[model samples]
Target: MIQVRGIHKSFGEQHVLRGIDVDFHEGQCNLIIGLSGSGKTVLLKSVLGLHSVDQGTISFDGRVLGDMGKKEVKVLRQEMGMVFQGSALFNSLTIAENVRLPLDFFGDMTEAEKDERVRFCLERVRIDPESFSKTPAELSGGMQKRVAIARAIVLNPKYLFCDEPNSGLDPETAIVIDQLIHEITHEFGMTTVINTHDMNSVLEIGDHVILMEKGVKAWEGTMEEVMDSDDSAVVEYVFRSNLFKKLRAALKKA
Candidate 1:
């Protein structure tokens, strides 16, 4: 599990995160949802160690990130995986090659072992062997995202972080990706953190949801609790969609 305690961060004169405290449990899809400038990105980056917090501690399991040595930090990073918003696969590399890149860089495996691991990851993400040699440009958006996911899990990481994972996909494709992430999180028992504003994803797979407003954690709960919540911030943020408003009304009637 990942724990954030009273973490604060600022950039120049702009304060991004303010005393944000939350726990992201293992084997669950913990979602950080908010508007464009709601500090969601900053909080995610802070947890990923891309940005330093001004106060408080971010811990993986029980080890505080602020106290880890460089070597220790490196080891921790090796156990973490990230999927970017753009499905950041290289256009020049084939699907298999992209998935193998992490293994190539950090793995001590022999050539045969590397090949087996790469094949296993690709297959785990449901990518066919036929497309393994194709470049990212040749595949559809959904396929590219799957390839990205394959790369993220190639190392069998303990922590998985996704930034706007469903971005740019059609609704149906988005749902498929959401379900894929959900399944992988439980299957691998990884602590998965996803930063997204997609309401559908929030309702569909948000095992733990943290709603951010301004720079603070406005609310935290499961999806079912979100449906019943009367917190103004939760209501204002969630009911922005007419569909959800109607759903809430139906739930109330029922």
Candidate 2:
């Protein structure tokens, strides 16, 4: 599990995250949802150590992150996997090469070992190793995202952080991607954190949904509890629309 205790962060004059506290449990899809510039992204980066926290503590399974030495920090970083927005695949590299990149740079595996690991990861993401011959440009956006996921897990990291995993995809494709991620998170008991504005994903896969408003944690709950929440800010952020109304109405039992 990942825990944030009174974490505070700011950028110059902008106090982006204010005393944020939350826990992202392992084997679950923890969602950080908020409006643009509401500090959700900053909070995610803070947890990942991409940004320094002004005040607070972040721990992964009781291991404090703030006081790690250089070598210890490097080891901690090795245990993390990240999928940035836009898939972040190298344009010049083939899909297999991209997936193998992490193994080459970090894992002390022989060539044959690396190939087996790469193939295993690709198959887990529902991609054939034969398809690895193609570059990122040759695949569709959804395929690229799948490739990115494959790469993210190729090293079998313990924690996975995804920013906008379903971005730039059609609705059906987005659902597929969400399911794929949910499966992997559950299967490996990975401590997963996802930053997204996609409410559909929140409803579909969120084990814990944290609502952020103006740099503070406004609310948090599971999907079922979220559907019953009366907080206007959370409702407005997640369910205030004709479409969401239709969806909720459809979910009502006879």
Q: How well does each candidate superpose onto the true structure, as a TM-score?
A: 0.97, 0.96
Output the number of the TM-score-best candidate: 1
lDDT of 1 by residue, 167-220 (tens): 999999999999999999999999999999899999999999999999999999
* Residue 192 displacement in candidate 2 (angstroms): 0.8
**Residue-wise C-alpha lDDT for candidate 2, range 31-109, written one tens digit per residue:** 9998999998899989999999999999988889998888888888888888888999998899999999999999999
lDDT value, residue 154 of candidate 2: 85
With a 3 Å backbone cut-off (N, CA, C), the pairs that clash in candidate 1 are none
Please report the candidate that would top lDDT against the real structure: 1
Candidate 1 lDDT at 207 equals 99
TM-score of candidate 2 relative to the true fold: 0.96
lDDT of each: 0.95, 0.90
